[model samples]
Target: MSKKLRNHDEVVFEQLLNPEMAKAYLDVALEEYEQDGDLGFFLEALRNVVEARSGMTSLAEKTGLNRQNLYRVLSPEGNPELRTISLILHHLGYRLSVQPIQS
Candidate 1:
């Protein structure tokens, strides 16, 4: 019998299909981004969630964004605008909220 190994990305995407898991993943990613200022890291995490939810085409249709634009914006080098991020999160069944920083 041969055993097949699942790709790491595939495993991640499968796990992220759950809303709660995706939310927690994004939260951790956001915290890491804040700590390291690595925009790419955060963007990649968001992209993973997007892929898990469906794909660029479906998200583009939901948010009325161009599919190509979404690919570009979610790329490692992509710098997305605030409105775009908000729209993406909204469509992903999440929202951004401000909380007081604890000292």
Candidate 2:
């Protein structure tokens, strides 16, 4: 669980509400996958949002990916390359998934 979700529900509620909080928390989960470029959490999070708001065609249009290639990369089983990931991040208005070093 994200510290943001677990410890900051009040803040989260005041700022993000439920669904947005879930996505933010999942962004935290993405950190665990980043060391190896594992796509599990990233894929899962994208799947939920994609299924909710639109499909690959719409997302691809926004990201400037070809629809067929976007479908392959965004598919739950696919591994999106860093460039594709960057484009998706821009299209989604999400940050490039980054982590902070522990002090």
Candidate 3:
């Protein structure tokens, strides 16, 4: 009998293929960010979305960002400015939204 193994990155990439799944992934990341104020999870989710959609090189071209720089900027340690983040999200077919926290 043969078995298949699913990798973490593969799962994430698959989730990114569905708009609802992708949004849920980002929503979890955003909840984490709201809890700890760490942007790594958020950025990582965005990077996964980009990779699933058009890849880093394509995103770099669309966003006018260098390929190497895009990798660096998408890293967990990255601290990209709002405009850069916005541009990347826009190119990836996503946008930021605000909502009131429930009491």
Candidate 4:
């Protein structure tokens, strides 16, 4: 079922309903990609894990991220740009990487 649009703002409709632009409004997720690898590689790895557990089609539907784009960003060999990485991480409940501190 389509979700309700309570606000009268036209942009809200576009952001929530438009396939072409909805992916741009996503926020960052939790900071888990810094554990032990290159930032992009770690993100792609986690994206795969989440996608497998949740199913990519369902995840894409809920996240407003096109499956094709998600694939490109999360593929093992893919080098996702910052915005794309941010979007995927946000949708997957993950966040950006920060280097661990030395004791």
- Higher TM-score: candidate 2 or 4? 2
lDDT for 55 in candidate 3 is 96
> How do all the candidates rank in terms of TM-score, highest first?
1, 3, 2, 4
lDDT (Cα, tens digit) per residue for candidate 2, span 1-103: 6554455434443443345665676566576666766777667666555544556778877877788877677666788788787777566556574568676
Worst 10 residues of 4 by lDDT: 22-31
Q: After aligning candidate 3 to the native by TM-score, how far in Å is the CA of 85 from where it should be? A: 1.0
Point to the candidate with the largest lDDT: 1
Show where candidate 3 strays beyond 4 Å: none
lDDT per residue (tens digit) for residues 1-103 in model 3:
8889999889879879998888888889989999999999888888888899899989888878999988988889999999998898788677877899999
In candidate 1, which residue pairs get closer than 3 Å at backbone N, Cα or C atoms, i.e. clash? none
Give the candidates in order of lDDT, highest first: 1, 3, 2, 4
lDDT of each: 0.92, 0.64, 0.87, 0.55
TM-score of each: 0.92, 0.60, 0.90, 0.47
Over 4 Å off in model 4, which ranges? 1-44
Deviating ranges (above 4 Å) for candidate 2: 1-19, 32-37
**What lDDT does candidate 4 reach at residue 36?**
46
